[model samples]
Target chain A: MPRFILTFTLLVVLSAGGCSPSNEQDKLTVVVAASAQFAFRDIAEEFSKNNNVAVDIITGSSGKLTTQILYGAPYDILVSANMHYVEVLENSEKTHGEPFVYGCGVPIVWTMNAEFDLDSIASYFCLPDVERIAIADPKNAPYGEVAVKYLKSLGIYEKVKGKLVFGESISQVNEYVLNKTVDVGITAKSIVASPKLKGKGFYRELGEDFYIDQGMALINTKTTHDLKTKFKAFVQSEEGVNILESYGYKLSK
Target chain B: MIDLSPIWLSLKLALLTSCLLLIIGLPIAYALSQWKSRLKVVVESFVSLPIILPPTVIGFYLLIMFSPENAFGKMLGDAGIQIPFTFTGILLASFIYSFPFMVQPIQKGIESVPDHYKNISYTLGKSKFETFMRIILPNIKRSVITGFVLTFAHTMGEFGVILMIGGNIPGETKVASLAIYSDIEALNYSAAHTYSIILLGISVVIIIALNMLNAKKRR
Candidate 1:
C-alpha cells in the first residue's frame, strides 16, 4: 500500500508539472466556434508559422465557449460563430475590447450518400427514406439557428420535424454527415468546404442571404498578450481571409 | 417557466430501463450466483465494466457500431430499424450503461440465499423455476429494490451517453439532464435552475426513501 501510494503521488506530480512560465507566456490559446474549426486550424497554422509562436486552438459551440470564458477559461481569444456570444462575453465585462465581426457563415445541407438528391433540401428532407436528419442545437449554435430558420422559411419544419436530430454543435452535425449516422445534416458550408472533407460528400448551399456574422474578441481584459493581438490581426489579414474564403466563409467587407 | 417535457421523458426512460433491467438481470444474476468456474470472473468483470468506464466510451462505440455506413447498421437499416439519434438508441445505450447497477446487487442477494433453502424447495418437489420465484426471490427482496432504485437513479443521472447519441430531440431523446445542459449553454439560467432543483429534489427523495426502507428491513 505504501509503495502504491508513492507511485500514485509521483504520477500525479509528473502529470501536473507542465506549467513553465516562459512557455505559458509564449503560447496563445484561442477558443473557436465549432463551425470555424477547419478554417481556424489552417489560420492558426499560418499565424504560428508567420509569427514563430505556438498557437493552441480549442473548438466548441460559441455559447459553450462563452460560458467557459465567463467562468474564467484561460483562452486568450474567442472566435465565435456569431456576435451573440461575443456580446454576452462583453456584457459580462470579460472582453479586452469591443467585439468585431470577422466573417459570415452560410448554412448548407450535406450528405455522404452519393445517391441522395441535394438540389432541393426541403423536398429531399420530406422523403420517407430520409429517416434521420442532423442539425446543431439552435438553443446554442448560430448555424443551428440558421438551419432551423431555413427549414421554417421553406414551410417544411413541421412536415419534416420528426426526422430532425440535434447535435450540440455544427461540428457534430458534420460528424453525422461524414460518418453517415444521419441521412443528411444541416451544417456550416465551411465544414464541407474544408480540404479534409472537401469532395468526400455532397453539399448544397442555402443561399447567401441567410448568413451568420461571426465575432472575435480577446478575453484577457487585464493585460492583452502580444501573441493574442497578433493572432487577431492575422485572422483579418489577407492571407487569413484567403484561407477562410477557401473554406467557404464570406468576408463582409 | 420551464418545459416539463424533458423531465417527463427522463422519468419515462428511467421507468422503462428499470423494468427492463429487472426482467433481464434476474436470470443472469441467478446463473452467475450458482456458477463456480474461472470464466465466471471474466463474465462478472464484463458486466461491471460500465461502472468503471466513462460513459463516452459506450457512446463512441454505439455511434460507430450503429452508423449506417457499418455493416451491422446497414443490415439493421435494410430492415428499417433505426438506432442512432432516437429514443430507442438512447434506451439501448442506457441499458448497457446501467447494467451493473441492476445486476451486481441482485447477484449478491442470490448468493446470500443459503443452499438449504433451495435444497428444501427441491425436496418438496418444487421445480427450479418455482423455487427461484418463491423461495429465492422472497429472500432477496431488499437486493431487488436496491438494484431497481439504483438503476432508476443512475438512468436519471445519465448525460454523457445520451448527449453523444440523443440528438436533443424534444419529447423523444431530450431528457432533463440534457435540457439543463442546453439551458446553461444558452444562458437560460432560470430554466436550468428549475430543472436542476427538481432533479436534485427527486434524487434526494429517492435516496432517503431507499435508506428508510433498508433501515426498516434491518429492524
Candidate 2:
C-alpha cells in the first residue's frame, strides 16, 4: 500500500512538471503594434484554429515596442506602424534582418458631434469656437506625425497649436473624439472605420502624401524557435494583405 | 530646468482631491467604524474597489460615464458643466483613484478610538453629531493627516486615469505624470528623467515629513 502511494505521488509530480502550459507556449509569443491588434488577433485565431500552437500577442506603439525589444522584451514578431522603428531595431542589431513593408497607413480627421461638417472641417481650424483638437504624440506615433504634416499642409499648424491635445496612441485619439473630450481629432482611417465611432463622428480621408508605409520585422537574435520566420511568411502572404485591406489599410506589393 | 505648469497642475489636483476626499471620506469612515453589519462589510469592499482595480479600467468607465453623449455627461453638458479633458475631470479621477487611501486609514483611526470618550460626551448632554465632531474627530486627527498625505502623494503620481480621461491637454489636464509619459513616449529620456527625479524627490520629502510628524506625535 505504501509502494502504491509513493508511485502515485511520483506520477502526479511528473505529470505536473511535464504539463506546465506556460513554458510549452513560450515559443508562440508575438508582439505587434497596437494599430495592428485587431488584424493580428484575427490572423492569430485563424492560425491557432488549425495548429496546436498558442500565440501571445502584446500590442503597443511601434516606438515603445522597439524600446521594449531593445530592453530585452521577449518578443518574436514586431509589426510596426512605420519602418523607422523597425529600422531603428535593425540598425541597433536587435532584429534578425531587414524589415518589410506590409501595409500603408492613412490619416483621417474625425469629429464626434454632427454639428461639424466633414467638407468644411478643415476651415474649423480657423474658428474661435473650436477649443480643442486631439492628435497622438508625433514624436512616437506615426499617425501623429502624419496628422501634423496634414495640418502643416493646410497652413493651420500654428493656428491649432494651443488647442492640440495629444493622446498616447491612435486609439486614444479616437477615444478622445468619441468621448467628445476634444472638439475634433486626427486618427487612423481604420479607427474611423470602426463601428464604435461610425455615427459618433465624421471623418475625412487625408491625401496619400500624408500616408505612412508601415513595416514589420522579425527579431531573430532573441527568438529560439522559427516563430519569426513563420510569422514573417504569414504576414507577407496574400491572406495577411486581405486582412489589412479589410481594415482600410493599403497593402504594399 | 523643468516646465513648471504640469507640476503646478499636479499639485493643485492633489490638494483639491485630498481636501474633497477628506470631507467626503471622514463621515463615511466615522459611520463605518460604528457599524457592524453585513452591509457595512459590502460598503467597505466597495470603498476599496479603486485600489484593487486597474487604473485603466477605472479610466475607461469614467470616460464612458462622463462622455458628453452619456446620460450623466449629457446632463452636465446641458448644465454647462463639462467634465472630460478638463481640470474638473482630473480632480474627479484623482478623487476616485485615491478614495480608499483616504477612507481606510481614517476608518482604522476611528475604530481605535475608545468608546468611553463617546459615552462620556453623550452623558454630558452632547448630541451624537457634537460628540463625533468634538470627541471622535479630534482623537483621529493623526489618521486624517495620514490619509491626506497618502491621497495627495497618490494623486501626484496618477497617470493611467488622467491620461485616459483628461487627454493630456496642456495647462488644462496635463499633469506631471502625463508629462513624464509624454517625454518617455517622445524618447526624450533626459526630460523624462528630470521630471521623474523631481517628482520622486517631492514624494520622498512629503513621505519623510509625514513619518517625522507621526513619530513626533507618538512621542
Candidate 3:
C-alpha cells in the first residue's frame, strides 16, 4: 500500500512538471497601489486574455511598492496611486523610462453611518456621535496625503486631528470604513465604487480639486519581458480606460 | 534625529502590560494551580490559545469586536467607552496576546510548591489568601519574575494586533514596532535602522538578564 501511494505521488508530481515549464517567459508581474486593486485586476485579466500572457497583480501602498522596487523586488510594472511615488522610483533610476499618468483617482468621504451628514464633512468630525475617523497613513498613501490636504484647506485639520486614525493604506482605511469601526473615512472613490463595495456604504466625492493623478511605469530589470511592455500599453488602451472609469477614476488622457 | 517617542511608547506599553497582567494573572494562575477538574484542561487550552494563534487572528477578531457595528461594541460605544485607535485599546490587546506568557510560568511556580507547605499553613489556621500570599508566592519568586519579564518583552514586540486596531496614531499607538514598520514603508531607512537597533539591544538585554536570574536561582 505504501509503495502504491509513493508511486501515485511521483506520477502526480511528474505530470505537474510536464504540463508547464517552471520559468514561463510570457508571465508579467504588476504591482499596484491598494486603492486601484480591483480596477487593475480587471485590466490585468482582460490584458491576459487578449495577449495569452499570465499576469500577476500585487497590491500595496504606493510608497511600500516603491520601496520594494528600490530594494529590487522582481516586479515588471507598478501602478501607483499618485505621480509622486512613480517620480521617486524614477529619481532612483528604478524605471524603464518616464512614467505616464494612467488615471486620476477622486478622493471621497465614505461612511456606513446612516445618520452621517455628508454635506457637512467638515463639521461631521466635531460631532459627538462620530468618535473615530480613519484615513490612510499620509506618509505613504497618496489618498491619505490628499485627505489631510483637504482637511487643512478647510482649516479644520487641527480641530479633527485628535479623532484621526491612520490605516497603512487606502485599503486598510476601507476596512475601517466598511466595518464601521470608524464613523467615516477618507478614501479613493474607486474603492467605494468597486463592485464588491458598491452600494454597501455612502460616499460623497471630495471634488476634482482633490483628485490624485495615478501613475504607471515599467520597472527596469534584466528580466524585463516583452509582455511587460504589452501590459503597460494595454493599461493605457481604451478598454483599460473604460475599466478605470467604471471604477470612479477619471482618464488623464 | 529620529523621534524617541516610539521607543518610550513601546517601553510604556510593555511596562503597563506586564504590570496589568501581573495583577490579573496571579489570582487566575493560583486558582488554576489548585484546580483539579477535567475542565481545567479546557480552561488552560483557552488561556494558551493566544500563544498558539497568530497575532493577526487576534487582531482581526478584536477589530470586529471593537467596531460600533457589532452589538457588544455598540453597547460600549453608548456608554462612551471607545476602544479602537486609543492607547487603552492597544493595552487591552497586549494583555490578551501576552496572557499565556504571564499565566503559565506563575501557574507552574505555584504547582511546584510542595502540597504540604500549603496544607501546613491551612492547618495553622492561616486563611487561604494569606497562605498563598506568604507561602506560595514567596516560593515562586523566580516564576513570577519570569512571567513578568516574558510578558513585558512579548508586548514590546507586539505588532499585528496593534496594527489592526492601533490606527498608527502618533503618541498613542505608534510604538517602536509599528514605527519601524511605517519608517520602512516610507523608505526612511535611517529611522528604521535606529529603531531596529534599539529594539534589538533592548530584547537582547532582557533575554540575558532573564538567563542570569534563572542561573542564579539554579545555583
> What DockQ, between 0 and 1, does each candidate earn?
0.02, 0.02, 0.02
In candidate 3, stretches whose alpha carbon ends up further than 4 angstroms from where it belongs are A1-25, B1-219
lDDT per residue (tens digit) for residues A55-131 in model 1: 76656788867764654345688999999999998887888878899888888888888887777767888999999
Q: Which pairs clash in model 3?
A: none
- Estimate, for each residue in B1-219, the C-alpha lDDT of model 2 and write its tens digit: 767677777777777787778879988898899898889878999999999999989987887787755578788878988677677887898999999999999999999998999999999999999998888888887888889889989999999998667766556777889888765543356788888888999999999989997998889
Cα-based lDDT at residue B200, candidate 3: 99
Q: After superposition, how far is residue A123 of candidate 1 from its true place, in Å?
A: 1.5
lDDT of 2 by residue, A56-134 (tens): 6655577766765654444677888888999998987877778888888877888876777777766887688899999
- For candidate 2 chain B, the 10 contiguous residues with the lowest summed lDDT are B181-190
- Model 2 segments beyond 4 Å from truth? A1-23, A195-200, B1-219
The alpha-carbon deviation from the true structure for residue A81 of candidate 2, after best TM-score superposition, in angstroms, is 0.9
In candidate 1 chain B, where is summed lDDT lowest over 10 consecutive residues? B181-190
Models 1 onward score TM values of: 0.55, 0.52, 0.53
In candidate 3 chain A, where is summed lDDT lowest over 10 consecutive residues?
A12-21
How many collisions per candidate? 0, 0, 0
Query: Residue A143 in model 1: shift from native, Å?
Result: 0.7
**Which candidate tops TM-score?**
1
Cα deviation at A151, candidate 2, in Å, is 0.6
